[model samples]
Target chain A: MLETVATGHQAKVSAERGAERSLLSQVPLLSELPVQDLTRIEQQCRYRRFTADELIVDRDSPSTDLLFLVRGQVRIVNYSMSGREITYEELTSGAFLGEISAIDGAPRSTGVMAIEDSLVLALPRSVFLDLCTRYPNLALKVMQRLAAMVRAAQDRILDLSTLAAQSRVQAELLRQAQAHRNRPNAAIIEPIPVHSDIASRVSTTRETVARVLNDLARKGILERCKGALVIHDMRRLQSMVSDVRG
Target chain B: MLETVATGHQAKVSAERGAERSLLSQVPLLSELPVQDLTRIEQQCRYRRFTADELIVDRDSPSTDLLFLVRGQVRIVNYSMSGREITYEELTSGAFLGEISAIDGAPRSTGVMAIEDSLVLALPRSVFLDLCTRYPNLALKVMQRLAAMVRAAQDRILDLSTLAAQSRVQAELLRQAQAHRNRPNAAIIEPIPVHSDIASRVSTTRETVARVLNDLARKGILERCKGALVIHDMRRLQSMVSDVRG
Candidate 1:
């Protein structure tokens, strides 16, 4: 009976390891890593769960463990001194977080809140650094990701400094459409972006987002379908964005 | 004699090498590299010069050589499709540029314009990547720099999205004062910031910047001295910023 119990326990542990390995395979940085290498790092990590609307990482926290989002979604956000919340970006499954603080040992730039029930694989800072040092490609991938963030941020800053409110709304739609690529010269924002979510992205109010959508719909640029917003006049819409971006 | 000519040539070459070494020493990323390592990289780089107001790196250029600013200043800028100019940031001597493109092999995010007669040391993208791969500390520094940029940009985005025009001005002054820390509870903005520069930073008009300064002076929050702007009440100024940030 004791021998059978030992075998059953081994099977359970092996099943958990198999599940962990599958999640690790989803991370773009670790995707190219060999199976054994992925197994080695995942073994050094622990799994954690957070429920919807729960804080995953505190902004002022000093801990800096790199986290891999294996399932569900989370958003990077911060509250103004006045307690107004600002959402920076959202991450879905297969994405990762905490690399900035992990690399520099600084407090997080913003807090992370789970938008849905999330399962994360957390790797200690030391182990993550060692992994980067061992894999040049991993380091390059991280650098590229950081560079893209900088580029996106700069574009936003420029837009905020120059574009009018209407143009800003148009520019934001084009941005969203580009992110959700479609056929040649045509695009659709799938999952139907909420007015408040688009408001945050464009640094405006939900009312303004609704107004802009109405204007676009009337102009035959875009229209809301059952579950998506279809952008039809890609050329005209792009011209509107460039009108102020110019 | 041929031997005498060779000796003179060697002296001239050593003098150039000495100057290059001193400049490389100033780069924060390369400062920790050994003298021989610095010399090796410098030997592989070529020096380039630009006149004041000249374009150093075109925004659409395909080249991605990492550049070290050995002398003078350059501003990262972009023109809107309609010809409106946006100044992103400025880099002075000892600072570096082009790492974003070098890491991602992407197009330049913005053009670099020489603000004064300048000298730059250009290293091939491959050499820079090789150096980063070989030096873990160097990679860490680059990552840290990129992270800092993201943090700063996010702060700007939040301010633009929420703060009133006057509050943005107050917040900007607080930001600049913190950057140029002086005695506790007081700070001096030396060389007195130009209204246009502050305008760009706060995403307001030059008139707005001037009006805000005048209002602050009337309230005894800050005063204009002969060559600088002095903040006499840092706490009050900070409180005003937090009023909106809050």
Candidate 2:
């Protein structure tokens, strides 16, 4: 079921019937689908690969394929008319994209780029819509995902409205730490993006982010390692956020 | 199938069977549904009335009923832990609420208050879900609405992040003008919310909003009438937003 069609530095691990079922089972949305429906979905998936910094989908493009990240990371971004880039979100493995455009049949709102060499499974819009129509639970799951997305956006708006620059940077750091935390009472975020990327996410300048981060490091709250950040005192960092929000 | 149940200042307009179907037919989600399915949905709706400024649903309340605004307006707002009020959105007739929480089975994310004496038809969660399961088109319609909501929230975040205080206020006014514009090349926004409310929506102080409005009035871009703001130069106001955004 797991067939290695090509094995090299950049390999293509083709999924057969059983492997496809297992992969679909791991996805929250497709997992609830019945075995037959899952099989149908798997049959429609086409595996694709992109190297780091590759443009997967251009902004305003008419691409409506649903993409599921099989490996690595992708960033959704928008470019202003003046050529300023705003990063909306960074999604890692197992996350999906293009649901909004696919559902509404509108042009893509943001461009998606591969931040790291990535493997993705693309499902055509027709197949995705058919599945949603045939499977009620799948439709419900999609709605739930959309609802959660709306809530997260609202939270971000609240932070941007109320928090100061330093607090916003700190809050974004804490958020990333929580997302990538692997140990208890501490978090080590590896492969951290550059200060400019962080600035774009938090809507601040790179200099501001650097200043706040350096200040935090001086306070013994976090340390910058080779390619990651190690948060030593999460409680202190959390209190900092509360102080600003309060 | 139409029947008049009551007639008073605050009376429940209990809809008869045919009248209920006709009313449901007006809702975007239910309009496309088959007549029989629409009848089923109408059978489950309970007519409700609220006076102006009535608290229809409290934040975090376990109210899962789907509210369809039949007449009048409502505001969705959130109060922060520190008692800061944020107005999320305003809904008018034919719009639906509570779909997000009902889909996710989470507590109400925001409080819904009637901005005017409003008439709403509340559909129980079970009936809503049943209708969704049986009618895929209805589910698709719900997904599209959620998608639109997500996009709007994202737009708001962008405005908050990139625009300055004065520009943010101008952008919000332009948005309102577009929404309530009745005449070509001009707009009349009636019963405008207080300056404090506008400040809350745009994430600025009331004094700043007043200053901006006074400046605009002096420039002859807008005029403050008894209970409405008349925009004499919609193009000029719009160009202000483009200048800031660009």
Candidate 3:
């Protein structure tokens, strides 16, 4: 069902400017901004909420807002001609979205949907432009964040275009394993997401993921623990990643 | 046969700082930089030359430089285990390469090759860091550029993962036609490299490109003009793009 909300929704978005400044201080992009600038940015920011499955922004629409996720999860997705949905990337707290379109005054390339109840700090394009006009440092920090994201996408493109289904799954698992290793004192192995969600990211089907995971488990490379695959041999998995980008 | 010359030939790099500043002035990423800052950046630039088929940068190497195309073309490519090469994008004048890795201090994600005898302005990572420190405006512009690139890649990912071979080819042809429309009015469509090049970019076999072009020719959708495919029906071709991306 399509629901249209009034633009007055903007009025309801209250900014706790002091709180926002402190919160944004923890974010790399905003943290780089001097305290005075951060406070000015926070004063112009507004908070908004989205329920699960609601469209945060529609694809191809003129984007006028920048979103900084404060809570919950989101999925970047698009629809195919067959009416089949393609999930591209998942976003969580601290992630920024829609910045390019907002910055350039262009239409958005993909749609955003909340995967869970989401709270976001939404900044208007006008305010963002004002900040850019006032502070070059803020712009540089934004670019640094964008550059890092683009690099990640480059790695992902290499994997998707070159790797086999099995290798793609393995490499993704290794990526998650490495990410988990950064968390303190936890078992280095991560609780892998459901096979379906994993399939969405790899552009494969759940059946294929299940089959591959089962095979890996049989080989004693990964084990089922608490219904999640726990990687036991990272070297074996790392060897598989090169093949993905070969 | 490998041509053995000095590891680096007379490099033929044109580091004309004034000309670079002018050229960069036209590009959005550097357009906003003050004239003085632009001149400073130009001083830190160096030019490099590469012969056709030369690997300018290999996959997985540390990224220490960013390339600005002054003249000629380069191909951004990835390879599969079975030795199949896929051309992701072609870079011509005004295009920048490796900025993502350069900014992120990460390894190169794809191999860059000189598609023709090419001249490029190479900016070392240290210079980039200096620019970031000296001019935040330039940094923001770089970030916006990176964000746009990421969006472009996301679009490509959707295309490659979801579209069929023939549809992808047709959409690519339409894109090319749009791009060439701005070129000086000419009787002949420009000569593209080969069917294989087109196939690699769209992630299909060369045979498929040949077959599809022939089919389109037979259908009066496209015609051969001076050995180049001249699109005869743009409306029908646009519909194909919509259908593929729908």
In terms of DockQ, which candidate is strongest? 1
Going through the candidates in order, the fraction of native interface contacts each one reproduces equals: 0.62, 0.64, 0.54
Go through the candidates in order and give each one's DockQ: 0.55, 0.53, 0.49
Question: How large is the i-RMS for each model, in angstroms?
Answer: 1.8, 2.0, 2.6
In angstroms, give how far residue A65 of model 2 lies from its true place.
2.8
Candidate 3, which CAPRI tier?
acceptable
lDDT of 1 by residue, B145-230 (tens): 88888888888888887888889888889888888769888899998998887776566778999999999999998999999999
Tens-place lDDT digits, model 3, residues A1-246: 223223565344333333334455655556567787766665576666789989888888875788778778999887666755667778888787888787777888788899998877778898876666566666656766676666666666666666777888887777777776543322245455788878778777788889988987787777889755577776676776764454
Which segments of model 1 are wrong by more than 4 Å?
Answer: A1-22, A81-84, A179-185, B1-22, B81-85
Which pairs, if any, clash in model 2? none
Estimate the Cα RMSD of every predicted model relative to the unseen true structure.
5.8, 5.3, 4.6
Report the lDDT tens digits of candidate 2 across residue range A129-191.
888898898899889889998887877777787778888999988888888777665799888
- Quick one: ranking by DockQ, best first? 1, 2, 3
Backbone-clash count (model 2): 0
* Model 3 Cα lDDT, one tens digit per residue, B74-192: 99987777777878688887777888677767788788889998776677887876666665566656666676787888877778767877888887787887776643331224795
lDDT ranking from best candidate downward: 1, 2, 3
RMSD of 1: 5.8
Predicted structure with the largest lDDT when compared to the true one: 1
- For model 2, the superposed segments whose C-alpha errors exceed 4 Å read A1-28, A32-48, A81-83, A180-184, A191-193, A225-228, B1-26, B33-48, B180-184, B191-193
Q: For model 3, how many clashes?
A: 2
Error of 2 at B105 (Å): 1.4
Give the Cα lDDT of each candidate: 0.81, 0.80, 0.71
